[model samples]
Target: MGLWDDLKMQYRMGGITQRLIFWNIGVFLVSLIFYEFRLGTFIFPDWLALSSDPLVLAIHPWTLLTYAFLHSGFLHLLFNMLVLNYAGMLFLTFFKEKQLVGLYILSAIFSGIIFCGAYFLMGRVSIIVGASAAIMAILVAATTYSPHMPIRLLLIGRVQLWHMTAVILIIDLMQLMIENTGGHISHLAGAFFGFTYIKLLQTGTDLSKIVTGTVDGVLRMFKPSQPKPFKKVHRNYNTQPRSTTASKTAVKDKKQQQIDEILDKISRSGYDSLTQQEKDFLFNAGK
Candidate 1:
């Protein structure tokens, strides 16, 4: 296969996070191509910026959603995509695919709103573009969901996921006070959404449901309908009863039943009530 075809195949087979990164990279490259050829610029213009201009922002409101797919430079795209891949995989472990897509789009839009709000207040008039805000949202979500989850640093030993998230937030806060204040503000918005999303989920209110429905609707349009076929049954003239593997199976079943009872007790009285051996078992099982 050709290089382009291979890339397409890889992208199609990639997970949600990878697919998003591919889309952002593809858009960024297209923008670069246009810029290099001196053709019509693919970058969104300032007039399309979501600022105080109510009419413009209303008519082209889709830009708020699309802007996250556009990136300025290679380094910018690389960092954002890397974070997205890591966080997105973690997010899928607990969330449904539809919820993941919904959260991503919502995070992107909220990030744009914060970006424009900051620009307007700070007297900066420039079009905002990039997936950094959305990526930050995913990062916050993953770290918050698994705060004690260990992650290895290059030179340093392992640290809790929450620590990494805190460092990122601190840096972004400091940056907001210095350069690219609007961008940092956008990061804050994404972080807020991520944090709040987890909180709300704990309380049983999931905002991702709306996005899930929309995605399901779109997918249903392309699905083909198939009729059920009749099944045929044959009678056996001579049948023998199968004997149960009692000896070996009984031992395994007893172990599983004991584990289930322990889990049920923990659910009833909380993990603190679990004995040291039970705690060790749980930890090792998780690993």
Candidate 2:
């Protein structure tokens, strides 16, 4: 397969985390059209990027979550996606993809609100855009859930999950008074939200349900209603060979059984547990 076909196959086999990464990258590419070369920054419209002004936010509140899909630069997008992929996969190991999706969206809004509030208090007007906030939430959430989880790092040997999270948080804290203060504030806000999410989840209260429910509700609104089925009527199938029909049914059942087995393996041991052959089979089945 060509590169595009290869990527499409990969996307089909991968889970929600891979889809999320693709979305961020897709958004970044589209956003390049609005880049202001002269200013060395993207000049997104007020409705797109989160503004510190309360009035602006009131006019376009959706920017809170929308901003998280945007990035300031190529490196900014790259760094966030790398961390997101790592943390998101770790998160999926323990939580459902639905919860991860909700956490990402909710945390971005929480972080954006905090960032806007901070800037408003400082009497500064500015716009912020990046997935760092949501990415931080995923990373911190995973770490909170599995602080003792061992991770192997290049040239650093194995380290506890919390060690990595602490270093990142410390860097953000130290940079609070330095440059990109708004970005740092948002990152910290997202981290706090992540930690809080895990705590509430442990208490048997899942906050992610709110976002997921809202999303489902909105989707239902746009969903095309299915047509009611007519009354069943018996039809002669002797026109086609009985053996051909039986053979097709057997093939279909076999394919479905294989699919079910692969899915069960994924559920029990995570997607990474699948062998290359199984991955290829799943991808081809999807096609």
> Over the stretch 1-287, how does candidate 1's per-residue lDDT look in tens digits?
34564455446435576678788887777666444322433444533333434455667888788778776566667878888878887787778766677788999898887776766676666566777788788778877788898888789889998998999999998888778766788888999999888889889998888788777888999888788988989887744433345665787788678778777875466445766677555444434
TM-score per candidate, in order?
A: 0.70, 0.86
Candidate 1 structure, TM-score to reference: 0.70
Q: Write the per-residue lDDT of candidate 2 for residues 1-287, one digit (tens) a residue.
A: 34575578657657889889999999888877766654565667778889999999999999998899998777878888998889998998899999999999999999999999999899999899999999899999999999999999899999999999999999999999988999999999999999999999999999999989998999999999999999998976688888999999999999999999998887687666877788778777887
Output the worst ten-in-a-row residue range by lDDT, candidate 1.
33-42
Off by over 4 Å in 1: 33-44, 47-55, 219-287
- Candidate 2 wrongly placed segments (more than 4 Å): 38-40, 233-246, 253-284
User: Cα lDDT of model 2 overall?
Assistant: 0.90
